[model samples]
Target: MTQALPPLLDDDQAAFISGGVSISAAACRSGGLPSMARATGCRIAADRRSITILLSATASAGLIDDVRRNGAIAVVFSLPADHRTLQFKGGDARVVPLEPGDEALAERYVDAFAGGLEPLGYPTQVIRCVLACRPDDLTAISFTPSAAFLQTPGPDAGNALRSGA
Candidate 1:
């Protein structure tokens, strides 16, 4: 009997996918093209099977007096190795003005005092926080493997079998 193969991500080809660089690695595996878009530096409103990236754009002309506006960017991908396709949708992003002493506020959010004691002196605020809200900002990645490739077994398996177990 043929032994089951390990997950595709465990293969050498998967190294490129986790490197957080060029999408070409995944593309090659899927036998599909790769693409990328600039991240607006906005916080992630939500992350599920699909991720939402929020970006604030400047308003012009008679457009609503609101300076902050939301937009949606969609990404679709097919995983050839997995023989599956996925879709993602994102939108509902809003921009807000930068607040002063933002770094201090951020520290407060992350500060977790372990023991009970008098309030400790505040640390110097070194970061600033910008508020941006987005209900949805869609970006997607997918893959679809070829049937022939899926059915074919790697030579390594045959070698291991010949060597016993």
Candidate 2:
């Protein structure tokens, strides 16, 4: 029985996460060791409860396996220029196949990510190379955020995020 979780992200937070922020995820492997991976992109459901994060299958195999095993996941989104960051934790993660339009979404994410970095002195080509992935190697992890935190550096870094809008 899967109960629908209320969305933790408001409209503004949704928009921020949808943008080309840096995304990474972590899950625990056997013995509680952590597996981490860089996510290529993400999609927020219309209901604002479930968020699907795209990962490179080859690069994220360990993380994917951990998610499959434990269903516990934590993902972070951060803007390179401002250091604004958010962390979302969930205990109901699931690994799934990428839908048809996800490839385009990943490409757009890569473009926006590169644009965000170009102003910060990172070459666009270099940024693209760093996030490059094959379409066939793409996988998705979907989870409903049960907890949200402010991870940006400073006094309130680890505080629970209440509202941004």
Candidate 3:
């Protein structure tokens, strides 16, 4: 039998996901064509086995298609005030409709994100414009991470962490 793979994400990582930071989700398809979308919110499963990213329906068409066709995804979350970042690679991705309850999560995320942006010199209006969206236009992509990497700007930026080992 094979040794079990390590847990893909930790509690700290999960906090970053749902802590109202900027998230960028990407998917690649045939011939390595890539598509990306900014996520308004992130929700980690209670079991810590997966993540759900909330994105705009209109802006994520290509990304949705890419995930459907390839089932491969890479999500990057970056803290604006500092360059600290993490990237998670996942398989078994799927796009789904966001439920009614997801809207509140999005609202909380937008507010927290804007608060974080203030120290970075982005005004409230700019934050609103960047994250503004209607509930009807929101969709979710869920996936289980198979790999995680620390991408904070430094010598260790590209290094895969303990989980990916």
Candidate 4:
């Protein structure tokens, strides 16, 4: 059986996701071709069973197509301040239509992302362009994580959080 994520994401995890940390999503083709793209923001489902990522279709055209063609995906969220990271692997990935206010979500994400980068000495304009996107072309990709692993720096990285196959 698949072990579900905790009933609620912990404070650190929640902050990392909502704080506009760097987001990267990847999907593979049945033939093993793979693609990836940067994501603007992430929303965890109410039930904590899934994650919805804000991706610009213009930027992730190949990754979006791969997810539609193959339902498996891997998303990694990392904080720019620290290398703290987490990866969620799922099998039910999909390219769903963006809901009404998702545009604002992306906007806030870009703002936060730029803020995060600024402290690290990156130019503001460069950071904004790194995640620029239009709502009309955005899509929400949701996935239920079938597995979770520790990806923090040090010896425990890659350790499984639960006992499962």
lDDT: worst 10-residue window of model 3: 1-10
Candidate 4 C-alpha lDDT tens digits along 31-108:
777899999888876666668999888889999888888798888888778888787788889987777778998998
User: Residue 162: error of model 1 in Å?
Assistant: 49
Provide the TM-score for each candidate, comma-separated: 0.20, 0.92, 0.91, 0.87
Which candidate ranks first by lDDT, i.e. highest?
A: 2
Q: Is candidate 1 or candidate 4 better by TM-score?
A: 4
Per-residue CA lDDT of candidate 1, range 1-165, in tens?
A: 112432222232232222221111111112333323322221211211122221222211111122123232222222233323322332322223333433332233223211101133323132111222121322222222111121123443222111101
Q: CA lDDT, every prediction?
A: 0.23, 0.89, 0.84, 0.79
Single out the weakest 10-residue window by summed lDDT for candidate 4: 1-10
Sorted by lDDT, highest first, which candidate order results? 2, 3, 4, 1
Cα-based lDDT at residue 109, candidate 1 = 21
TM-score of 3: 0.91
- Which numbered prediction scores highest in TM-score against the true structure? 2
Summarize candidate 3's per-residue lDDT along 1-165 as a digit string, tens digits.
Answer: 012654577889889878867899989887876999899999888877778999888988999999999799999998888878999988889987676679999989999989888877888787788778887888899988878889999889978875543
Error of 1 at 95 (Å): 9.6
Off by over 4 Å in 1: 1-69, 93-165
**Model 2 stretches astray by more than 4 angstroms:** 1-6, 162-165
List ranges where model 3 is wrong by over 4 Å.
Answer: 1-6, 163-165
